[model samples]
Target: MLNLKNYLCCLLLGVVFASPIFAQVPVQKNTFSGGITVTNNGISLLPTFTLGKPAAIFDFAVKSKRWSFEPQLRFSLEGKPWSFVFWGRYKVIDD
Candidate 1:
């Protein structure tokens, strides 16, 4: 159930990472991120932890290259609505 933004971003990342031109280039080597989640019922769940029942959770991710991008995929455990978003970084940052 992947979304368009995820596919596109992953594709672009693959192209950037797989090309022989940047093969030897050593950019950022790693990433680490996590956030706390708050439920509408007034409960909070920290990352690496889980709530006993269905709850709203928010997540974030970052890509570290100069022209990097991040796409998010989200799903609901209740009504099961899903979505994807593309955000952060663009080629227009030519500075």
Candidate 2:
């Protein structure tokens, strides 16, 4: 259902407020930010995902860190909804 999809997106957005991994474990702090976005992937045709929209995205990354996590937030379209992605990275090579 459309409502269900929206709810899932909302949940992702809300829960993604945690600190990122690269922030703590990094050779250098990378504060990378980009412009606003809308309708990245065209899954909009699906009747069940009518409300499928996207917003802007931000990515912050660090390298050579251990036990770190990077949290990502992406939108479906303009004012549509947001999804949360949590990633943890460990440095295998110290170099």
Candidate 3:
């Protein structure tokens, strides 16, 4: 009888502690969708590749309630094969 009482108490405590997890509600938030950027690197003061040519950049962004991801690709409008850049951002604190 003592063993049965202890088992019931443990089960009750476990259910109480785990109930919140099953009742969670998801959050929704606003986020940026897409953007565009145009840049010229031909006349850069610092020595670099591309030799100062105009390029068109396209960007796409995807975001969750607590996380954001952005991927960008760049190509020379003048038919020069340049480089591709990939990046992402994560939210640590909300105000």
Q: lDDT (CA) for every model shown?
A: 0.54, 0.54, 0.71
The C-alpha TM-scores of every prediction are: 0.34, 0.37, 0.52
Question: In model 3, where do residues sit more than 4 Å from their true spots?
Answer: 1-32, 42-51, 79-81
C-alpha RMSD for every candidate: 20.7, 26.7, 8.6
- Provide the lDDT at 25 for model 3: 79
State model 3's lDDT. Answer: 0.71
- The whole-model C-alpha lDDT of candidate 2 against the native structure comes to 0.54
Clashes of each: 0, 8, 4
- Candidate 2 residues lying further than 4 Å off, grouped into runs, are 1-39, 42-55, 62-64
* Residue pairs in collision within model 1: none
**lDDT by residue (tens digit), candidate 3, 1-95:** 99999999999998998888778676686677777667876333245645467877778888876677787666688765566656777788864
Top-down TM-score ranking: 3, 2, 1
The TM-score obtained by model 1 is: 0.34
Write model 2 residue lDDT over 1-95, tens digit each, in one string: 99999999989876785456335653564443334334445333245544443345554444333445566556554544455556778777665
Error of 2 at 14 (Å): 61
lDDT by residue (1-95, candidate 1, tens digit) is 47988999999988987887656756664454655354553233243333345554555655454555555444456745344455676566644
